[model samples]
Structure formats: structure tokens, C-alpha cells
Target: MNVLLQVADTAGAACVFLGAAICLLGVVGMLKLPDVLSRSHAATKPQSLGLLVVLAGVALRLHSVMDLATLALIGFFQLLTGPVASHLVARSAYRTGQVERGDLLFDDLDAQLTEPGQEEGQGRRDSP
Candidate 1:
């Protein structure tokens, strides 16, 4: 029982370290990436992953089932919301033409923009 507790503690520490590293990398990616779309993409995945991993670590170290369940709920909510929020932000950027089109490999949205009746980015480009 003692050994099991020790093992759980060690695993929790390792997981927390890994989660911190992933979060650091994501921050670096956001800073280094060229545009809003790229930064948004970078920010979402690792952030969610880091949160889940850190939550798992905390769950492992925690004794109560209730605490673990709380962590699980938080992780679930993070997983559900992170990508949706990222997608919405990205969609807003794309729709408003804030995305750098030349950097994109291909664009299905661009095709839609060219459709005869479509508005085609009725967004204003304000320059600083």
C-alpha cells in the first residue's frame, strides 16, 4: 500500500512536469507563429492536452473519489469547450479575412467566397 502511494505520487509529479512542458511549448508556438489563425491553432491543442494531463496528475495524487470526479468533470468541460472556442475564433478570423490566405495550403472556404451570390468577406481591413 505504501509503495503504491509512492508510485502514484511519482507518476503525478511526472505528469505535471510533462503538462507544464507542453503548455510552455504552446505559448512559444503562439508567440512564434506568424498570424492569428496559426497562433489560434497552436494555442488550442496543447493547452487542452496540458490541462487534461495536469488534471490526470492531480486525480492520481488525490485520495477522494469526489475530488477525482471533480477533476474529470473539469477535464471533460475543457475538452468540450477548447476546440469549439478555437474554431469560433478561427472562423471569425477567416470570415473577416484576417487569415493570411497565401500561407494556407488549400481553402474550401475560399471557394465558397467566390460563389456568385456569396458576399465574399464583406469585412473591412483597418490598417494601423
Candidate 2:
């Protein structure tokens, strides 16, 4: 039992460390990314996964029922809300035309904007 507990502790620490590293990487990516949408992707995906890993590690290190329940709740909230928040941000950025597509190979939004039937400058309030 003692050895098992020790192993779990080590594993939990490793998981937490790894998660923190991932979150740091995501932060770096966000800073280095050129645009709002790409930065949001970096933030949401890695940030959510890193938090999940940290919560799971906490659950493993905590043997008490209440602690585990709290950890589970944290993980559940992260899982349920993270992607939804990211999607909302992305969609808002898209609709608002705040997203940058500098290196895009093919852009559907560009095509839509250039289509014949679309009104001129419908979303281009800032354009001269």
C-alpha cells in the first residue's frame, strides 16, 4: 500500500508538471501567433487539456472523497465549458471579421466576400 501510494504521488506530480509545461507552450504560441483566431486556438485547446491534466493529477494525489469530488467537478466544468467558449469566440471573430488569414492556402470566406451577389462593404465599416 505504501509503495502504491508513492507511485501514485510520483505519477500525479509528473502529470501536473507536464500539464504546466503544455500550458506554457500554449502561452508562447499565443504570443507568437499572428492573428486573433490562431491565438485563440492555441489558448483554448492546450489550456483546456493542461487544466484537465492538472485536475486529474490532483484527484489522484487526493485520496479523500470530497477532494476527489471537487477535482472531478473542476474537470467536468472545464470539459463542458472550454470548447463551447472557444467556439463562441471563434464564431464571433469570424462574423466580426477580426480573424486574419495571412498564410491560408484556400479561404472560403475570401471567396464569399468576392461573390457577385454580396453587398459591397457590408462588413467593412472601417474600410476607406
lDDT of 1 by residue, 46-94 (tens): 9999988898888889999999889989999998998999999988898
Give lDDT: candidate 2, residue 52: 86
Candidates in order: C-alpha RMSD to true structure: 6.2, 6.0
lDDT minimum window of 10 residues, candidate 1:
117-126
Best by lDDT: 1
Please give the CA lDDT of all the candidate structures. 0.88, 0.82
Model 2 lDDT at residue 3: 98
Off by over 4 Å in 1: 121-128
Superposition TM-score, candidate 1 onto the true structure:
0.86
